[model samples]
Each structure stands twice: as C-alpha cells, then as structure tokens.
Target chain A: MTENDILEAAKQAVVAADEEKAIEVARQAVALGLDPLRVINEGFTPGMRQVGDLFERGTMFLPEVIIASEAMVAAVAILEENLPAEQKEKQAGIAVLGTIEGDVHDIGKGIVATLMRVYGFKVHDLGRDVPLQRFVDEAKSSGAQLVGSSALMTTTMVGQKQLEKLLKEAGIREQVKTMVGGAVVTQYWADKIGADAYAENAQEAVAKALELVEG
Target chain B: MTSYPTRMGDGHAVEMSTDELRCDILAGTEDAADRGRIPALSQEEQDYLLDLFSYPGKIVGVQPGNEVVLTDDGSVNALYGAQSSSGVGVPLSRELAIRVYERAFCMDTMEVGHPDYSFKPVKPIVSLEQQCLESVLSSTIIPIYYGAMPNLALYAKPDGPFGNPADLLPQGKISEARAAQEEAAQALTRDMVYVGRKMAEVGADGFNFDTTASAGDAEFMATLQAVEELAKTTELSIEVGMAAEFVLGMHGQVTYDGVRLAGLYPHEQLKLVEKAGAHLFGPVVNTNTRRSSAWNVSRAVTFVKACSEAASIPIHANVGIGVGGVPMCETPPTSMVTRASVAMVEIARVDGL
Candidate 1:
C-alpha cells in the first residue's frame, strides 16, 4: 500500500475502534520502512484527535472515546516500539492528573487521562480523591511537565488551589504548569485561583496540556 | 366511598378545622383496611403537597445526589446506596412516605423522587398516591430509577440487584455483569408496573422514570425498555427524566462501529420520551456549585431554553446547585436566588417559553 493509504487505513482503524486492525496496520507501516513517528503523528494521533473532537462536540460518549483510545494506544505502542530509544523518550511529554480530594467523580478525569495518553503524554493518573500532597509529590517524583486536577464539586475544587499552594511550599511552583477543570470550573474560577490554565472539557484539557508542555 | 361533609346546616358561618375536612375526605375514599394501615395526613401536610402541584409554572426539585451513609458514630462515608445501613434502605412506612412526599412538595418539587438519600419502597407507592389523590391535588409524580447504579454493597456479586459498574466492560467476563444489569433492569420494570398499577387504581396523575445515572447505552436502553413496559401497562402520564449531558452524548457525540448511539439533545430526548408515551419532561441540570454570578445564570438559561424548546409537555427543570457543606459565595443567598430567577425569566421571555 502507498504511504498515504497506510496512514488513512490506520486512522480509520482507530475510528472504527478496531484495536487489532490498528495494531496490524501500524505493524505493516513499520515493515514498509515508514517513519514510525510519522505513523503515529500523521496516522494514530490524528485519528485520536478526531475522537477527541467528536467527544468535545457532544457527538461521542465516554464509551466510544474509551474504545477509540484503546485502539490508539495499541497502534501507538507498536509505533513507539519501532522508534530509537532517544527519539521515543523525547517524543511524549510526562504529566500527572487526578480528581482532587473529597471528590469521587472520576468519569471526567478518566476521559482526560485517556486522551492525554492518546496524545502521547506519559500520564500518571492518581485516580479519584487524591490528597493535595500526593499531587505535588507525584509531580515532583515523576518530573511531570503538567499537573492537571479535576473537581466536579465546588467544595472539592478547593483542593486544586491547595495543590498549587503545596507545590509552591515545596519550592517547585515554577517547575511545573497547573491546569484545573470540571463541571463547575469556569475560566474565571481558574483565574481567581491563579491556575496556569483552565480547560472546560477533556478536549480543551488536551489542547492546554500540549500548549503548556510545548510552549 | 365516603362523602364530603356538607356546610353547616344552621347557616351560621362555621370555621371547620382542616383535620375535620380531611377526616371527611378520608371517610369516603379510604377503606377500613387502608385507614388502619395508613394514618390520615394533617391539614398542613395536605396543603404542602397540594401547593406544589398547583404552582404557577413548572415544578422542579433538585437533589445533589450527595446524601452520604454515616457510620454508627456519624462519620460520613460511602454514598447512600440501596443497601446502606440507614433510613434509606428501610422500607418507608405509610406515614413516612406521606412525610417524604410532603417535604418534596414543600420544596416546590412536584415529583417525589430522588436518589439513594430518599426513596419510597415500591409497595407503598399506590397507597401514597391514593391518599394524595383523595385529600390533596392530582398531578403528584413519583420518580423511579430506571437504570440505577448497583448498590455498592453488592458490587462484584454475580446476582446483584442493580446495574453493576463493571458491566460497561469491553469484552470477556462481562456476561455476569450484563446478566446482573438485565436482572436489575427487569426488577426495576416490575416495580414500575407495581407503582403504575397502584397509581391507576387511585386515579393518581402519573410517575416519572429517570435514567440520569445510567452508565452507557446498554444501561440506558435497558432502562428505556422498562419505561416502555410501564407505558404499555398504564394510561397515566409518565414523565421521563434524563441527564442533560447524557442526552447530548447520545444524540451524535460518540460513534463505535458496532455500538448504537444512545445520546440525544434536549429536543431529541424529549422526542424519544414523547414517543414512549410520556407526557411530561424533566431535564435535570445538576451542577456541583451554587449559581453565584451571571455566568452561572447564563448557563442555566441556556440549558432551560433548550429543554423548554424541545418539550411538548410541561418542562420541569430539576436543578441541583450548591453542595451541602460548601461555603457560599460573598453574594447573599436571597440575592443569588433573585439573580438566577431573573435570568430564567429573561431567557424564557426571549425564547417565548
């Protein structure tokens, strides 16, 4: 198959949520001496980005996004395996994410984490009700480029600001970027809390995370 | 059936107590068996339930779904689920059901349905509806969970009584979860049948079937089946309550080759509900914080307008704002309420709702 045909097939595989087909296409592209990064960036990533777009536009539900993420992850894993160590290591940015303390709503956080992984972020998801100290400590330990916190309730959103304060107290505030989001989180609230960025939804979170890491 | 008490024969204007009136109303409607089992409602309670149904506009009640189950020492822990060791799990007594209905009504809520925090047992729905219809206003609505989350205490059990969270699995070992969810959905339908029958027996208005907490298309469709089943069995109007975002998700958001899209927007959701033979619609907007500013108000207005436009039946916006223990904004509560109300009115007028 031509290079463009292979890339389109890979993208379609992910969109169709055919994990095995995605992996098979990625393997074929690698065997064809196609650039592995191109296979990921031009093929898998675009497909995942479309999935993210569908989700953001309310055209996709969590289950579809999740299945697509799985397909993307499967294909990306194959492509990353074909990359040289140095290039592969440098390709994806590291990040940490979680639902703040006193909140158990993990659906949104789970979506963000999955999308971040799809977009080639080395994500450390701390799950729900993560304490403020854990966020800072995990970011410091993992050397995350971005720390994202989600809070579905206004009461628990306090933990996001607390996490920022803790990062400062640890003298690492300047070392990392902080982003906040959830159902009740507005850009105004983000500004009020002095967060580096605010994402209204998972797609926006991915975009902001990219801007923070790349910029 | 008992007859209504006539006005005083002497022509002297008599101030009859509410209890006397209620007693007379109960005499004709309630049989000896029912009277012995359920106590007569006080005048104040009757008025509380009636006033909500008679409100000028749509009736809305918001529950944050945050009611927690406390340990014996009173520390709040897990969510109040079906098996929680609290007042929630116990079958509600006849008197308690009346009080529950009364409290919901007093909150300007037309429907007496909430999450695990408060629910009437399926058995008492008929008696409760009967009492309300006889002494109070019609149009009382009882809300039922169509696809409820599995009782956490029953998590991982093969025969669990509700939809297990694990049922959303992608592949193998999901059969048990699917079976469990189907069983739960069937159970819910059976309960709906019981409730619908009772409501019909008493000449009560109707009930609402809510699927807000459903996890995905499977759970949602299963719940819809239950709703359809209830419709087939009853002539009383049934209102369907769905999560706004879930509806949005189902309309066109997610696509999987083999997966059917269950997402719908407000209008589409209302259409589906209408096709199911329901005559009322409740679009629940459950936010985690208070509407402290115009931003929040604008969001509410946008959501309300969408729901109002899509609904052919009366739309009840079940809005849950502000967590229980959260501190309020600097703005006073009264001011916040006024601002929110004004925003809603302006939006309604602009949209011609």
Candidate 2:
C-alpha cells in the first residue's frame, strides 16, 4: 500500500477510536519506512483535531473523546518507539494537570492531559482529588511552566483558590502559569482566584495551555 | 402538518414539523449517547418519544384542571441567591431565607440549603437547619424540608473520617478503595439520619436528599440505606433528587437491594429510589450545551418519560439550570426553559418540577 494510504488509515483509526486499527496503521507506516513524526502530526494529530471539533460542536460526547484519545495515544506510542532519538519532535513545554482536592472528576482532566501530550507538552497528570500542595511540589520538582486544576463541584472549587495561594506561598507563583477549569469553573472564577487562564473544556484547555506556554 | 414549538441549538425559538422533531429527537438522543458505547434508544422507544412530543402547541402545558406541585431544591436561595465572581452562592440567615421563600418567591413548599449552600455535609449544618426549622415551623404555613448533598468526597481527608479514593485508587491502591468507600458510606448514612430525625422533631414536613450519588455508586448506596433507615421511624416525606441522568460507578462494585447500583439510568434509579422508601424521586437529565432545547427536551423526555411511566411515587423532574432539557448556562433563557417545562409536563407527564 502507498504511504499516503497508510497515513490516511491512521487518521481514520483515531477518529473511529479503533485502537487495533491505529496499531495496524502504525505498523504499516513503519513497514513503508514513513517518518514516524509525520504519521503523528499529519495523520493522528489531525484526527484528534477533528475529534476536538466534533466534541465542541456537540456531535461527540466525553466517552467517545476519551476512547479516541486512547486510540491515538496507543498509536503514537507505537510510532514513538520506532523513531530515531534525533528525529523526535522537540517538547512543547512541561505542564502539570489535576482535579483539585475534594473533587473526584478526572474524565475532563484526563482528556486535557491526552490532548496536551499530543500537543507535545511533557505532562504530569496528578489525577483526581489531588492535594493543592502537590501542584506546587510538582511544579517545583519538574520545573513545569504550566499548571492546570479542575474542580467539578462548587464546594471543591474553593480548593483552586487555595492552590493559587499555595503556589504563591511556595514562591513559584510568579515563575509558573496556572489554568483553572471544570464544569462549573468560569473565567470570572479564574480571575478571582488569580489564575493565568480559564478553560471551559479539554479542547480549550489545550489551546490555553499552548497560549500560556508560548506567550 | 402540525408545527411544534422548540428552540434551535443557539437557543433561538423555532417551529418544526413532526418529522423534523422526530429526526431531531432521535439524532439528539444519539448525540447524548456515548457514541455507540451505551445503549441507543430503540426504534420503538423512539416512536414512544415522538408520540410524547406529537401534541400541537406553541408551548404545551398540563390541562387547565391538572396542575402539578412545584417543588425545588436550592429554592430558598432562588430569591436571595448571590452570585459571586467565584460562582459560590452567599449564605443567608434562616429568617431571611424564610422571608425569601414565602414573601418573595411565594413557594408552596419551602426548602433551604445549608447556610453554606446545599452541597455541604449535614453534620455541620444540622444546628443551622434546627435554628431555621424553629423559625420556619412557627412563622409560615409553607411546609419545609431540609436539603443537602451526599458529597462523599467531603467525608475524606481533612473533612470526615475516610481515605480519599481519589488518592488511593490512582496510586494502584485498589484494595483500599472498597474499605474507604464503605467507611465513607456509613458516615454519610449516619449524618443523614441524624439530621433527618432532628428536622422531623422540629416539625419539618420532610427531608430532601438533593444531588444524591454525585460522588458515585457508593454515595448512591449510602443514600438508599439512609432512606430505608429513616423510613422506619419518621413519617417525613423523603425526596431522592439525583445529580445526573445516569449513575457513575466510581466505586463500581457498590450495590443496593442485592442489585449493583453502578450504570443505572433514571428509570433504574427510580426503582431503587422506591425500594429504598423515598416518597418522591427527582430524576436528572443533563443537557447538551451545544444542542438545541428541542434536542435536549427530546433526549430528556426519552429518559423522564420512562421514569414517569415506572414511577409509583411523585416524579419531580429537575428541569432547572442544567438538567431536564434546560440549557446548561446560568440563567437559562426563559423561552427555552418554559418550552422545556411545558414539554416535560405534557409529554413526560411528570408530577412536578
């Protein structure tokens, strides 16, 4: 099969959330001596980009996005393993993401992590109900420039403000950027909490994370 | 050729033919599904849903003689509701809330969240509710129910007495989640019964478990257990208001009445709510923010209609803010809200909102 045909199959595999198809396409691309990075950027990445659009337009739901992301990640991992050390794409930035303390919602945060990883960010996912201090510690240890927190409930969202305060207390507030998001989180709340950005969903989180890292 | 009232994806008012609505409803329900992961509504179910919306009205409503009771959670805060930049509602005094419920909103049934808002633990809010009940039972004719969430997350780490599964399960500490969940559930049940009996003694008409099971299946099981235990003594009306259309099985293994509680939708949820001895059931259907009110109403009615059909007790569908086909935005537009309300009552035949 042609290289272009294999790459197109890779893209469709991600869109269909067909992990086996993604793996098969990755293997075929490797057999054709195609650039692994090209397969990711030109193929699976665009598929994820379309998935994000479908999700934003209400044509897709969270579970589908999650599945698609998993498929893409699995495909990317296969592609990355075969890449020469010097041929790897440069990392975008380092970021830490988590659902804040007292909120056990990880699905949105998980999507954000997956998208961020595809966008080339070295992400440390702290998972759900993460302690506020952990964000500061991870930022310090990893020297992550971007930190994102999600809180799905109003009661637990108070932890976001505490996270901002903890970052400042650790004297890393000025050095790192912070983004807050969740079902109930708003730009207003982000501003009130002194967060650098507010994202309404995972797609927006990736955009904001990129903007924050670049700007 | 009858045209029905509905809203566009952007919340604009619109009219559509029965065929258009049927397509929209089917498509909308499809969108609401997990993209072939969960069960899609069968064609027979789709036909039943279309029939519910088949009535011709600019906006349908219950017949002139058949009005339903309007019960609400977080109702006291409706009038005195303070929106902060942080989106937290400001807590108000018991007396001020009573005035707002009676003099302002003139609500038939008065319900109050904790002074810190309803999504808090009842243990700390019990005295506050007691203080409010002392004033409410004497001052107004409105029947009052105490409302709070079974927020199991709060029962963990620096709050209550359990390990945070959020920390445990993620770290591959899978064996500990079951025990942590059990302890948290027990604590939540104790607090609910304690506060319930306290309100019952103070002349409260009932207890409302608003937003039950938001934390997951463990939280839901606890609420069911609390309802059963409370039913033994107090004749107070218990309302089980759900947090979502389907139960997320965070604990995954939790069960009630010998049936697993995880993955139960509104109809299945109501059956357990009845078995648990709740006098009222509030089924929640989340809205797709990017979809039209018609789409949301159709998808919501698909679930609520089933719940209403199976319900023996009162079914008060939560149609406010983000659930029950209403828009997800704060201050959901009155036009769509009204249209959704009308469709719910006329189509789903819910007993109340």
Candidate 3:
C-alpha cells in the first residue's frame, strides 16, 4: 500500500474501533521503516480528531469516542515503541487533568486527555473528584506545563477558581497554565477564575493546550 | 365510631374501627366490602393520611381489624385524595404554579380529593424544594436523573456490533445499515428503561432524562420513549434535561428535522417533550462560577425564563458552581448557598414576582 493508503487504513481502523487492525497497521508501518511520527500525525491523530468532531456534532456518543480512543491508543503505542528514545521524549508538554473535587463527571476530561495524547502531549489524568492540592502537587511533581480541570456542575466548578488560587499560593502560578472546561464552564468564567485557557469541548482543548504550551 | 367486620376481596372477613377503615380507604387498600361506600373521614384523618403518603414510605402490613402499619421500605408513596391547597398544598411558589398552570392546563384541573370532599387548593408561591416535594406528594411524580450516569457497557449487547463507527453504516445496502442503527437505538432505549425502573423502584416523583450523552435524534428519541413508557406504567412525571445551548439552538447548532427528529432546537424539543407528556423542563446551564459571573448568571436566568415562557411546566434550572462546575464540593458552603439564593431570586424575577 502507498504511504497515504497506509495512513488512511490506520485512520479507518481507529474509526472502525478495530484495535487489532490499528495495531496491525501500525506494526506494518514500523516494519516498512515508515516514520512513526508521520504515521501518528497523518493517520491516528486525524481519525481521533474526526471522532472528537463527531462527538461534538452529536453524531457519536461517549462509548464510541471511548472505543475509538482505545484504538488510537493501541496504534500510538505500537508506533511510539518503534520510535527512538529522543524522538519519543519530544512531546508538546506535560499536562495534569482531572475533574474538580465533588464532581464525578469525567467523560469530558477523559476526552480531552485522549485528544491531548493524540496531539503528542503527556497527560496525567487524575480521574474525577480530584482534590485541589493534588492538582498543584501533580503539576509540581510531574513538571507539568498545563493543568486542566473539569466539572459538570456549577457548584463544583468553583474548584477551578480555588485551584487557580492554590496554584498561585504554591508559588508556581507563573510556571503552570490552567485550563478549565465542563458542561457549564464558559470561556468568560474561565477568564473570571483566572484560568489560563478554556475550551468548549475536547477538540478545542487540544488546540488550546498546544497554544498554551507552544505560545 | 362503629366497628364492623368487612369481607376483603380475598374472601377474608376482618373487624376494624372506623379510623382503621378510614386509613385503609385513604391508603387505597379498602376491603371489597367498603370499596364503594366512600365513608366520611374527618379533616384530621384526611391530613394524617396525606402527610403519611406525602413522603417516601409504604404500607408494609395490614393488621386486619386493628391498624395498617406503614414502613419506610422505599415503596411508592402516593396520597389518593388529599385536599389540594393551591400553592401550600402542592408546595410550589405561586409564580411557579402560575407558570406550570399557563403551560400545562391539565395541572390546573388536577383534583386533590378526599373521601368527604375534593377541592382545588389555591396556588401560593413557595420555595423550590417545597414545590418539588409538594409536586411529588400531590402528583406522585419525583424528578430523578440529576447526576445520574448510566454505564454504557451495561447497555451494549454482547456479540452485537457497538462502539464501532463502521457498524453505524450499512455494509452494502441502506436497509441493512438502517436496521443496525435501529437495533442500536432500541438497545439504548432498553437501557434507559432499566434506569427508569430503578428510579421508579426508589419512588422517584418523576425523572429528568439526561440528553447530554445522547448521540443523535434517534438515540435521544429512543431514550425519551423508554422514559415515557416508564412514566406511563409508574405514573411518574417526566422531565427532560438539555444543555441550555441545545435548547436555545445557539451558535447555529440547532438541527432541523420533523417530529421524528424534533428539529434539535430548544423550542421544538420542548414542544416534542410536552407532546410526549413531560411534566417538567430542566435547562442545564454550562458555566463556572455561576454566582460570580454576571454573564453566566444572566445567561442562566434568561434560559430559565425562556423555558418557563415556552413551557407550562415548572422550569428547573441546573446550574453548577466552583472549579469544575460540580455543585457539591471544594467551593465554600456559603458560595453554594449564595449561588442558589441568587438563582432563585433571578428565576423569581423572571416569573415577574
């Protein structure tokens, strides 16, 4: 198959949620001496991005996105394994993501985490209902450049502001950028809470995380 | 009061006091002998039965001629014929009652009856919680589904094609693909019914169907139908919760389709829900720091007002606060209380109170 054909096959595999097919394709690309990064950027990433778009457009639901993400993760693992240590080390940035305390809604955060991984960012997902200090501690411990918090309720979204305050109190506010998003989180609220960035959905979260780290 | 032995429908004759008979009748378990007699119950006896059934409890056992004991076993609690006291009786604020009345004509004529007399209570403005409780007691419809997250894996058919986008399309023919989608949608509805059954078993007053996770019009409608079926059997009110944006169709996000799809706009969706016999509308506002941000607060207020105006049912605005917008934690207790107070005031204002 042509390189484009191989990349297309990988994309189709992820969209099809065929983890074995995605891994097989990634393995074949590795055996063919294809650049792993090229395969990821051209193949798996696009597929996952499409999944994210489909989810946002209400054409796909959470389970589908989750399965697609699993496929991509399987493909990426195979591809990353073939890459050299130095190349593998070069990621966009480290990020700490979690649902704020008292909120168990993690689907949105999980989506962002998966998308960030596809975009070459190392993400530390703290799952749902993460403590305020743990966010700061995770960022400090992991040397993370970005911290993303999600809450599906207005009552718990206040933790985003509390996290911002805690990060500043930890004296590392300048070192880390914060991103907040959820069912109710708006960019205006993010700004009001002093978060560095806000994303409406997972796709925007990837773009914003890239900008926050690169810019 | 005279004591008498009455034969139950099961051919069992039991002796009971007038009060015991009144309790049995109020509880809707009167013996066959007295089923159609319609005995006169004092106001105190009526109120006692009304309060007993207002909260969550069930009659566990009936000591034939003596007493009917109620236990807190989470059974369906319903008041059969309690006198309705407009706002106080149903526990709703007058503004909310007015809004509900304006939208749903069925509510206004809803009779709260007793063995002696049935009267429509005057609608008085009351607190939201009291209103919800009163609505539950009077109507026996408790709204469930706030913060309810069903596990998707539980719904997926084993050995069935799911979680695969390829399965979403026809392999070679449109008919085949359509069948797959239909089956998938049916599976989703089954899951919703399962959730609804659990909610009903716990004596939910009503159910708020969560629309955030719905994939498209097909799945959304399927879930609605499933909940509607539950409501039919359980006699619980149905409330549909949608993101405020989805309801308003803001940002050009509204998808237009016929009744089958409901056009994906807020107003259209509201109409469809009403047509489907929903009793309440919950518009969920997605914003952080709901109390602090004027924009967020105003947006929520506007959305609630729009819902109230569009539908006759009571509008329940689901707004979050704090870091991730979860209402339960991390934020100070005062902040949550303040946000709730502010939201209530704003909602009341929208009702022109």
lDDT of each: 0.54, 0.76, 0.53
Q: Kindly list the per-residue Cα lDDT of model 2 for residues B110-226, writing each as its tens digit.
A: 776663543345566678678777787788777777787777777876465788765555333545866888898998888888888888888788889988887778899999999
What does the lDDT read for residue B144 in candidate 1?
21
Pick out the ten consecutive residues of candidate 1 chain B with the lowest summed lDDT.
B69-78
**TM match of model 1 to true structure:** 0.60
**Per-candidate interface DockQ score:** 0.10, 0.11, 0.02
lDDT: which is higher, 1 or 3?
1
Best by lDDT: 2
Per model, the share of native interface contacts recovered reads 0.14, 0.00, 0.00
Q: Where does model 3 exceed 4 Å of error?
A: A102-104, A117-120, A153-155, B1-231, B234-353
Interface root mean square deviation for model 2, in Å? 7.3
Give the top-scoring candidate (TM-score): 2
lDDT of 3 by residue, B141-192 (tens): 3222211322222232332444322222211122443344456657666755
Ranking by DockQ: 2, 1, 3
What is the TM-score of each candidate's chain B when compared with the real chain B? 0.51, 0.85, 0.44
Give each model a TM-score. Answer: 0.60, 0.69, 0.49
